[model samples]
Target: MITRLAGPAMHRPKLILVLVGIAFLICGAIGSMATGRLTNGGFVAADSESARVAEILERDYGMSGMQLVFTVESDGGAQAPASAARGREIAERLRGDERIDKIVSPWTDPAMGSMLTSGDGKIGLIIATVLGGENDAPAHAAELADELTGARDGVTVHAGGQAMVWSETGTQTQKDLALAEAIALPLTFLLLMWFLRSAVAAAIPFITGVAAIAGTSAVLYLLTFAVDLSVFALNITTAIGLALAIDYSLLIIGRYREEIANGRDKRRALELAMQRGGRAVAFSGLTVGIALVGMSFFPMDFLRSLAYAGLAVVLMSIVLTLTLVPALLTLLGDRINRKPLREAKPVEQSLLYRIARVVQRRPAVCALPVLLLLVLLGSPIVGVKLGLPDERVLPTSLESRQVGDLLRDRFSGNGLGTVQIIVAAPARDGAVPDLRDYQAALSEVADVRSVTGPAGIFSGGELRAPAGPGTTAADSAYVAVATGLDPYSEAGQRQLDALHAVPEPGATVLFGGFAQQTADSAANIAQGFPYAVVWIAVVTFLLLFLLTGSVVLPLKALVLNVLSLSATFGALVWIFQDGHLGGLGTAATGYTIATIPVLLFCVAFGLSMDYEVFLLARFTEEWEQSDKTRQANDDAVALGIARSGRIVTAAALLMAVIFLGISASGVTMNRMLGLGLALAVLMDATLVRMILVPAFMRLLGTANWWAPARSRGFLEKVALRE
Candidate 1:
């Protein structure tokens, strides 16, 4: 099928090339509109307990996760007439905007008390709610923040909150994507030229890359009308599309050059290269697409958008590889080799061949140490903890991050880190629960600095008031538990766990707050993790088996991929989570965001399998051409590595450079993702695919091709490799 398709594409290369250019121009225009439509928030699962509570608050109380806070700092106390008057003036001005639902300031509401005032009396908070909650926050946040950021009547103002943070994060992400590409494209081009040894050949991947990115962006734009797509998806789309484009182009162009050098006619070389390379591209794309599809099983829009973006990008790359790349290759013909830095090495005599021979001679010695090293590196994951994305995900230079730091450090006993306990009245009694007893239980819990409830404010087992204005009860009573520990820390989670265990019988209890939200997000991810693993494992094994016609190789591929991914995860924990990379001048977020590891596992695993498919496709082809003997198996292993290793290594190096450039992002999570992904690609290419794959193949010998006799017909029927 691929050979037939290539014949016409090669014959009418100019027409096909013209069509491709036209498609790019059209899709590029549509794709440019995707960014404005993409959202900045998707980190929360809509069905989780935290989301449920948030929804209730929004629907019933007209409250939302989105806020726009003005921190007005002045020399005089915030309660002084001058400071109070200034704050009210700003609030009153904002109140006239119909898009603003409510504005609260300590100047007008004495009940807010210290919750809105700094201990030193220099800082005061003016909190306002958006009309449409988080759904509409981003649109309003930028304009409101601009209106509120400047000084007013001698009071220095800083604007922040969830809305402000979201807007800034979106802006920073776009900047980072541009900066990453600026750093990556030139370096990638140079590396491609060095590998291909021809400038004309090196530029092909960039064309395919641009086409894939533009096509995928247009698809994402279409998806926006059906589902919310995250702004971060653009980064995923660009990086993965570029990497896959380079990878597929390298495979096809290198194979075409080899066939031409072997004295085949240009037409024959095009046919053979597309037949084999197209199959490999197809199977590799299926593996990646299936892995991305697994992320869609999780309810979080963050992961789901990646699923959509990644799948679209992979498919776009495959189409370009099969269509545009071959069309270009056919047009170039011998001119593709117009420039060469040096004489090309023979396949059996290259550096990769020499390395494979070394590994083949001592399979166990070569494989065991790498396996052990990976296991040792993965040990830190046993202690790994996850937290949801917060203001801390932003660069410290951002005003929102500064405000978050101020709140955490300056307000030790304030409500910023408080856990909200909502206790609904008994359905039979229609009366609020014993608020005093509930408050007592909460106060007695370890790490609970204080508890404010409808009955009173309780601390150290003492009630300071019978009825505190801060605690209001309608159909449900509210209890606020304040703790000194960081809400995302181990101690804080423990305190939250302890709060859940406190006695509050005959009442429907719901826990909500920053800490609880983080915990719930982590739990939601964990809940979907088993299904994601099963989907990837089952899908990849079936796809690899169909491609290779071997159960053993698919299993081996999974193990090698796991080993490589484990090493990447371990590095992530060490450098990003444990803060070890700070000395190396890399950014570190003290905890990994909950979605990152899952994101890494799915993406990195698929990428690992991509190289696995590339290498194994050659291994199976060589084996099928040889006699069914142990010596033939050995020869196949060595020959396959000799043929595919350079391309795999070159692709890995180029991709690693792209990932590292993206790691320069100001957001720590993006940096973590970039660094982890780069590490995974390089390690898989060098340690796993190059070293361990050959060793294990040598050890398995003829058994490497073993499959159930009954499954042979099914495998041959669906076989993706020529």
Candidate 2:
């Protein structure tokens, strides 16, 4: 199979490469077109608690629950020349702009009045939220910034709210993803070359990984039209794609080379590589892909994107494993083992022998240190802070970020996107009262800073703030309210629930905002994520167990896998979120990505397992012929490490470096995730795989073969048994 394809490709390599290139371009063009229409929008009523409560009672309830906040503040206490007057002018101009469908602020123009409030009571803020699918933000922002900034005016006028946040954050997120996308394969290539020590061999794995990314990226691009593609999706796809591609290509390439060295004909070698190595690659990718898809249960759009991205990358990896890799191997023929492939290095008296000697000698001495280290590192997780990602992620020089800092200390800043408590008209049994009790109750909440409509009617009913003629105490009859709190903090979440707890007979209560959203986001993750981990483990176990015919070996693989992931998680805490050693490269402002843990766990698991499969599969094979299971195991582990460990470690190190490269980015979320995942892979390659795996395996003894009797018997019957 490989010889036929390679013969024809080698005859005309340029033609085949060009055809592939053309297809890639066409796919990209189509994907780009599709993504163009798909804009990343802010999750509104989503971030608010009041909106959620209201969503239950009516149609379009979710749409009505979000509050739009727009504000412009003065630079410190310095009085600027005529800026306040310009801000007032901008407001007047917006009152008549056709692009603006609505304005909610304290402006007294009865015609344009919707609650437009003046900042400093001098610098006025305009609030606009899309209720009927209207976005007055772009036009409003353009006019305001142009009028304010264009005049060389020191006073800066900015428009922000759900829409603005979405527009800005989404664009930045794409750039970060693009950086990752561009770098994943090149990094994969360098590692493969350095490890394999053969340009052809190195090129093979990287080519496969790149194809997987490209093909899967096309597929994920298509899925975007149907679902919201989370910015986090690209990270997952690239991570999984690179790992699986490397694994898939590695297996086939190794098998092809092995067949050749065993004196098989070119065609015969290709056939064996396809028949045997291909099977393992298929199952491995499938298991990992299925695990990734499990994230969809979380209900967050971000997690959902990972589901499809994982699935796509897995499929792409498989395609390359099954097709492209065979073509490459057929083309390379005997050249793959450029180092003059040595006969299987004797593993009998190697590291495995030493470990076996440890297990056979003094198990307690070997295992104690290993177990103690895992527990010690896992301890800091007790202090884990699951804070939502913040806009402090933006460079301090950015207007929104600088102002957000001001807001956090002096006012609410971006953290103000919390606590939506609904105040509404009083209701009688089975009937809403003519009076707006919701508006009145809103004023009663101690956490509130401002209030907006229960003024308009939903399918549920109208809400109203407390009654008053002017800006003083008597203001009434609004939807629910707006409040200030540390968004997503313990106090903030409690305040949100308190607003929801208002049990008034006269009016309906609702809570919605950053706190409510964050709480829901956290809950959804907790319930949905265990499945992802389980699915990965179960599938990986089945595949590895079958390939090796050693239930014990899979357990060993799993242990190493877990350790790799845990070590990285701890490092992530120390570097990205804790601000300890944050000045070092795995560094960023002390904020983690909102969905990073999920991505980090999945990506790290896939990567660690990538090395696990490459090294252990060989051992499982050798152990088949050696009746002495311990000797075969020792030799395989030792030889596998000696032969491929350098390459895998190098690849991991390079990948980690690529991740650290992103630390230089202005976006804090990107830096956090980049640094977190980088440190994880680096630690995995050096400590977890090197020190811990061998030490523990040295201690497990034959009971590491703790399979149930029936399964053990089955494994023994199959040649896969070690």
Candidate 3:
């Protein structure tokens, strides 16, 4: 297949270049508009109890939970005439806004004034419900946050809550993406020039990287019209696209240069390069693409959006690597080797060849220590705790983070920690009695400070006040239960579980709050995790089996990759959750973001398999060309490592540099992703590929190439050949 495609590319290189240039221009224009179409929130599970309660609150009760929180502070204290007047002014401004569905403030509702004000009486709270769903609420909150946050009439007001946090997070992520590109691209170019040893050769990979990013963006732009995509997908696609494009381009160009140096003419050399390098790239891309498809097993749009973006970028990189890169190499010919930076090392004398020889001599001695070290590095993963992101994920310099700190430290029970309960009870004779009992039961749950409903305030299983203004309707009841625990803490999760366990009076009841939402999101991801893992493992095993024509080799590759990924997860827990790496400029949030591990596994696993396929292709090719003896297997392992090690090392270093640039982000989740990927790639290249693979293959001997007789026929039919 590559042979047929290489003919036209060699025959009309100029035409191919012109057509690719035109396509890039079109894609660049379309891709520039993609960010505007993306959304800021996909963290909540759409079918969870929290989401159902939110929907019912909006549709049946004509109200939604508090979407915005403002901390109003004055030096003169809460009851001072001037402070009271300023608080009323802020509430009045919000009350007139069309975007606000409901407002609760000490100034507006004196019935709950004591609960709304701080214990010291110098700070007060104002909470409002925005008039939209997840996507629209953040936009509305941003506008209100901009206009209302600042000093007014001598009272300082700061805006926060989930909606405002999402808004600020989206804006900050865009800035960080730009910063990451600025840092990664130029550094990558210099490294490429050093590795390729020529300006013209380096430019080819750089150009392909740009094309991959732009083309994926154009595809994502089109996808947004059909499905809702998260803004977070943009950062991931950009980094992965650039890294894979350059990696594939390096493989093809390196092989093309080797062929030319062996005295082959331009046309024949291009054919062999396309046959060998091009085939490996095809398998590598397919492996990575299949691994990313595992994300589709998850129900959240966030993971699915990432899957779409990842698949698009992988396809774009493969197409450009197979077509445009080969055409450019065809045009350059002998000139591709001009302006040498350094001399190339012979494969027999390479460092990887020497290591492979040492390992082959004492395979068990070499393998056991490395295995122990990896297991030790991975020990921290057993303690990993998962939760949804909140204001703590952002930098402390941000307004939302500051407000969250203040609320947690200085305030009492308020909207920030309130648990909203919606009960579906029709207007019936004995409804009030059942509701009273239910509220009393809820109030008795551990961590409950108070519960407010039509039965008024309930504490310690007793009523303390009359019914509030908007707690009841003819057919439904809205209850607010306040607690003092941090919503993302383990205790808070237990609190959520306990609340759900309490018996309800109504036939249907839904819980909606920050704690409940976080719990539900984590639960949803956990439920989907097993299915995703099965899909990734089964499909990856089949693909590797087809590639190698050996059942044992594929299984060995899967085991090594999983071990490498476990170490990566442990590092994430150590750095981000346990707060050991202060230099990364992110505070330890005490729990990993629920999506980070899953996202990292899918992406990094595919990438690990990418390098695995590259090395295995060379190994299989060398083994098939020699005798099938044990000594021949040893020679094949050494030769394959020596031959493919340079490409793998160069690609891993380049990819690591890009990911480390992304690690500089202020958001903890982005930082975790960036640093974890960097660790995974570097570790896979050096430890797994260089050390463990040679040791394992030497230990296994010729069994590495063994397969069943019946499966051999099927493997022959579908096997990838270089």
Instruction: Show where candidate 3 strays beyond 4 Å.
Output: 1-7, 339-345, 425-433, 469-476
Q: Judged by lDDT relative to the true structure, which candidate is superior, 2 or 3?
A: 3
Cα lDDT of model 1 by residue, 1-722, tens digit: 56665666787889989998999999989988888888877777887776776676666565564777778888887877778888888888888987787787888777675678887878888888776554577668778778767776677888777778888888899899989989998998899889887788888887887677788778889889888888888787788888898888899987887778777888898888888878888888889889888888787888998898789889888878888888898778777786442356677788888888899999999989999999998987887888877777788888888877777666554445668777778778788767787788789888787788777888777896666553444677767787776787777888888889987656888888878888887887888899999999998998888888899999999988888888889878887778784713433446678998888999988888888998889888988888879999888888888888778889899989988988888887788888889999999989987789889988988999999999888876777667
User: How many clashes (backbone atoms < 3 Å, residues ≥3 apart in a chain or on different chains) does model 2 have?
Assistant: 54
All candidates: TM-score: 0.94, 0.80, 0.96
Weakest 10 consecutive residues of candidate 3 by summed lDDT:
425-434
TM accuracy, model 1: 0.94
- In candidate 3, residue 672 scores what lDDT? 85
Model 1 residue runs over 4 Å out of place are: 1-8, 75-82, 152-154, 339-344, 425-434, 446-475, 482-485, 583-589
Candidate 3 C-alpha lDDT tens digits along 391-462: 998999988888888777777654576788987764555253357888999999987888988788899899
lDDT of 1 at 69: 76
Question: What would the TM-score be for candidate 3 when compared with the true structure?
Answer: 0.96
Candidate 2 minimal-lDDT segment of 10 residues: 469-478
Could you tell which candidate, 1 or 2, scores higher by lDDT?
1
Q: In candidate 2, what are the lDDT values of residues 283-399, reduced to their tens digit?
A: 556556655666665556666666776777787677656766666765677776766554655434445445444443554665567667766766656666565655565655555
